[model samples]
Target: MQLITAHVMSKHLSLSSFSFRAPQDSPEKAIPSRKLPFQTFLSFNPKKPLSLKTHLPIMQISKTLFVFCLISCLSMTSSQEQGATAYEMLEKFNFPRGILPQGVRSYVLNTDGSFEVYLDGECKFGVEGGYSLSYGRKITGKVSFGSLRNLKGVSVKVLFVWMGITEVSTGNGELDFYVGPLSASFPLSNFLDCPQCGCGFNCKDIVSDS
Candidate 1:
């Protein structure tokens, strides 16, 4: 018959390629397709594993670095007390801008050194052993290094009463002057200059001295 019908159609195409094989992977279906992308990245109460988009950018970068380090430490403490004055902070604590007099007009020290001095009112005068002092348009206390304590608006003039210098200090070279429990000393070249509020320092060298 035509060569036995082409050998039974070449043995039916080699038994359809060994009954079509190919599939193989199996460790229980490849571990649920590799745990389906780690269970869609959990966080649905998986014991609260940090997920407010990971603590909201770490609390917004720690509150923007604590408000930019508190406005750069308050602008470097107001640029180091701005124009610093009070007679250059009483020569930086050693004191003696003639113990303050000549219409100060304004002040305030405080960094625990406490102060306040202002003037242009309530003054008084006379100095040089005849004493007299006075000066209360506001003055206050607490200084250090060479010292000055409790003070409050000045005063002096003993021998005719009116006493309350409260405190002042220095040492060896002298310049004491307290009040209660009495004290006195002087001679730090008797306060360089700066007195006139009602005309003091020897009448500013007695007018026309020629």
Candidate 2:
């Protein structure tokens, strides 16, 4: 009986020792910390002045900002060169683009203030009077904001007489039309309405064939 009791006591002590022992660490968790030269220097000299190591990040940031701004400016210039149209160019010169009727096929503007405007073909339509107005296939003139000179290829009929309108000048909110030595003044507001190729001031195709 004594031998059996000793055997049972030894078994209980061995089981308790096995269960209470600390768990073994994994290979990754047991890895030892490695201190690099720079890390060791920083840890030893915390109050030391920052060297190029600290300023390198700031320099890189500055370089990045400069590149970004340069790219933005280049993109803006590219868009302006490609996006601006002929009508928008008219606005740039401070003139309303409506002065030219619709169906303008093309135009050439010179640096010396001269310009040539082209229509698809000859355009004619009746105006306020029973008389008719006609535009040739091409018109050439010197153009400034609110003014056109040496005009050609446009004509109007008045009182059964067809007169060539040679020049147009603007001032005091009025446009002066020159037909030979005679001139007529009309409100500048009249040009706000863009004319059509075959309908003159009418855009809704209301002009009758009669």
Candidate 3:
């Protein structure tokens, strides 16, 4: 009777353990038993797939990138309209800003490349190499890609007399300034600064000379 009762108790304990253990042969049924909230929703409806938690961050990132690009484009357009100055315009024509002196109060540039430059007053300054130049109140010229034609209101002192520079041209890495039938050529690097009136190359020297 003791042996039969021990056998019955062991058989009953084995049945209870088997009932509590998860079955390995059927993983599909076990998935539903431990399904997450989002998993349950997806299982119910196969047509609507993505959850809000998964897609919300992607939408937010896309919106942020779009706003950043829009602001950048607007800033560039505003700068092109308001930030462009006369010196920067000269750069567009492949000329150095130093070709024109400072104190440009106003200017008019036409679509045909003809332009007029107005200074604060007549600019007269002696360059470093003993050359005195004078620019009139208004200077008119037709500017091409690398040449200037029909230039007026500019002159240079030669000996005791000042002669007008009627034509100016640049090519072959040199700049040519013409007066009537006479012309002079200098290296293109010479006109890098627009000399100031009455100051020459060094204003301090002019002050000392005075």
Q: Candidate 3, after superposition: displacement of residue 93 in Å?
A: 2.5
User: Which runs in model 3 stand beyond 4 Å of their true positions?
Assistant: 1-83, 204-210
> Measured by TM-score, how close is model 1 to the native structure?
0.26
Candidates ranked, most accurate by lDDT first: 1, 3, 2
- Deviation from native of the Cα of residue 165 in model 2, angstroms: 1.3
Candidate 3 lDDT by residue in tens digits, 161-188 = 9999887777887777888999887776
**Which candidate leads the pack in lDDT?**
1
In TM-score terms, which candidate is top?
Answer: 3
lDDT by candidate, in order shown = 0.69, 0.64, 0.66
**Candidate 2: segments with Cα more than 4 A from true spot:** 1-86, 129-131, 205-210
Looking at candidate 1, what is the lDDT of residue 102? 76
Taking the candidates one at a time, how many backbone clashes does each contain? 0, 0, 2
2 versus 3: better lDDT goes to: 3
Pairs clashing within candidate 3: 124-197, 124-198
